[model samples]
Target: MRLSAEHAHLIRAQALELAGAQARVRLYGSRLHDHLRGGDVDLLLELPSLPANPALLAAQLAGRVSRALHGRKVDVLIDAPGLKQLPIHQIARSQGVLL
Candidate 1:
């Protein structure tokens, strides 16, 4: 993963803070490849239960994480018990590095 230890910790911390301790975080996309440069952070947050407002939660998590990362672009995808699993979610889970 391209993220520094501090960044990874921040992301995991923020995700858990908003989504609960049971949530799982993964890092995906170009940043996963060390050879790649200047890619935005791609994160998949897997939740144990569905949130009342998934979209709002996603936005809040993304905004908080992005600010924590010094304004770096952060893309957050959410996976919950009842939410539809998109292809991107599959790709992320398959290729993502757990953080």
Candidate 2:
């Protein structure tokens, strides 16, 4: 993966800072393939293991990261505990870089 440690740290830290320390973030998609070029950053964010409005929490987290990574198109997918599995989430979890 070409994702810099700084960016990864920022991604994870931003989730912790804006949301909570419990958020688990992963990076997936083209960014993961060194052979590929110029694609938006794809992120799968597992919401903090807490009780809250998952959708709103996801939007908040995505907004913070989007701002932090200015000029980059970021696609953030959120997963809540016990929620039904989505294929994207499965792919990300299996192959993505854990931020």
Candidate 3:
């Protein structure tokens, strides 16, 4: 992964703070490739239960994580019990590394 240990820790801390302790986070996309450079952070946040507002939660998490990373671009995808799974979600799970 492209993230430093500190960056990964910040991501995990922020995610668990917002989504609760049971939430799991994964890092995927270009950031996963060491040979790649200057790509946005792509995260898959798996929640044990559905959030009341998935979109808002995603945006909030993304914003907070971005700010924590010194304004680096961050994209978050949420997967939860009641939400419909998309192809991207499958790809993420397959390619992602746990954070």
Clashing pairs in 3: none
C-alpha positional error of residue 13 in candidate 2 after TM-score superposition, expressed in Å: 0.5
Total residue pair clashes for candidate 1: 0
On residues 21-86, what C-alpha lDDT tens digit does candidate 1 reach at each position?
A: 899999999999998889899999999899999999889989998898889999999999999999
Tens digits of lDDT, candidate 2, 71-96: 67788777777766789889999999
- How well does candidate 2 score on lDDT at residue 37? 84
lDDT of 2 at 67: 85
Q: Which residue window of length 10 is worst by lDDT in model 3?
A: 64-73
Better by TM-score, candidate 3 or 2: 3
Candidate 2: Cα lDDT at 64: 76
TM-score of each: 0.96, 0.84, 0.97
Model 3 stretches astray by more than 4 angstroms: none
Evaluation by lDDT, superior candidate among 2 and 3: 3
Residue-level lDDT for 26 in candidate 2: 91
